[model samples]
Target: MSTAAAHPAVRTRSLGDRRRRTLAWVGVSLLVVLGVFVAGGVAGDAASTTALADRNLGPSAGHPFGTDPLGRDLLARVLAGLRLSLVVGTTAALVSAVIALVLASAAAVFGGVVDRVVSWLVDLFLALPHLVLLILLAFVFGGGTQAAVLAVALTHWPTLTRVLRGRAREIVTSDHVTVSRQLGHGRGWIARHHLAGHLTGHFLVGAVLLFPHAILHEAALSFLGLGVDPGEPSIGVLLAESMRYLSAGAWWLAVLPGLCLLVVVKLVDTIGENTRALLDPRSAHL
Candidate 1:
């Protein structure tokens, strides 16, 4: 290679090209998510419409994912399920993230008694039986979309809280924070200006990573008949309904929808991981 091309700045410029490509991939993934949401929304009513005469069909040109025993189009139903999962997961993840951020910030900023209380709460939540807790919460809330969202939201925050708390504590003890305090800023002022601002990226990345877990939990509750109403063709509901027919040798009823769910989850996970990588100074070069 030429001396100019071998220069450190030139190598860094090539790395920038890789970073741009990573960004492009993220954009494409987001577009795919948007397309699924839109398609599902468009198929909302059709997802519930049934034609018994056309029931139990396998994949074909007309119905790409085939038809359920109720003869509702599986493709449409899966799309609708995905759309619903996206909504529930996104809402739950955001709520959970906020809860984590607040508790972590409080624990870090106010230390002593406040820190102890937050630590106790985080430990208590972390020690519980996660799936059982989800079921209990969903059951308590009367088992529907709202219940499922609440159950997932409430259960997923502890781990993230612990992570953010450590980061927040580091920030709190930093020279900049010390300087702000010496300038006569109150705890609230320092937290609002210094702590909150620095932690925004971490908060966002945590929320995105939490999304797949939220989606899966929502589906699990739905599969157990405590999620979205049975009238809604959620992936869980579809899988639940497919159980009986699998014995009758209707394999597509479960396989295709399940695969679709897996794919969507994996795609969201990829987005989160890449976003984190790009945001982390240590990983930005990769």
Candidate 2:
């Protein structure tokens, strides 16, 4: 049938399908960009070497992203930094999601006092400023990769835990869950077979959505000298070091790295939104 002549539901489904396809293509393009950065980081060794003679050069065939004041290739440094940021962000998000799953599941399966305590903790964390809390945690851990990861992981969990807890509560009241309970199925059995299995998609989407936040926070921490070591090639560190050279009119030093970070964050966010929509049943007719 012609699109205009089709039923409203059919048209809606078609539109949603097209949107999902477009989003899938965009996600693939983003992945390709990320892969290129990873490959460049692996292939480029010029980031570590300082060529004083070539310092502060603008973009060219020889130095596409130009050279920093320290004479390190900006392109290479950006790629390396991008890779590190992605690694740290993904690791932290995954850790956060896992913690959320465990705590949320426990609260749902073992209700009453446990649920109240978990819910209270979630509310408390949600009320606190994430960045400030993250910085404090990072500082306590002495400000390195471990500190950044831990801070991001710990700080990001409360929101996702609340979501999972709500879903778990709904599942607990389902007829199959009631039947399973009557059949002598323990909480552990229902959790493993029903709750965990059903909640996997939510967990995955939550983790993906958390990635950009983790990356930005990691970069912010590093920029403030509370994240990665100064010697490490991270996007935040590169931007932090670039401040001194910007006054000398070497704009590429800061601009390029900043753009790269922005692109990565935007792509991750887009992918997360797309994934969430795809997983959501309501979006089927959008």
Candidate 1, residue 45: lDDT: 91
**Global lDDT of each candidate:** 0.93, 0.89
The collision pairs in model 1 are: none
Report the C-alpha displacement of residue 279, candidate 2, in angstroms.
Answer: 1.2
lDDT of 2 by residue, 101-203 (tens): 9999999999999999999999999999888999999999999998999999999999999999999999998999999999999999999999988899999
So what's the TM-score on candidate 1? 0.95
- Residue 14, candidate 2: how far off, in angstroms? 1.0
Candidate 1: residue 68 Cα off by (Å) = 0.8
lDDT of each residue in 105-129, candidate 1, tens digit only:
9999999999999999999999999
Whole-model lDDT, model 1:
0.93
Model 2 residue 124 CA deviation in Å: 1.1
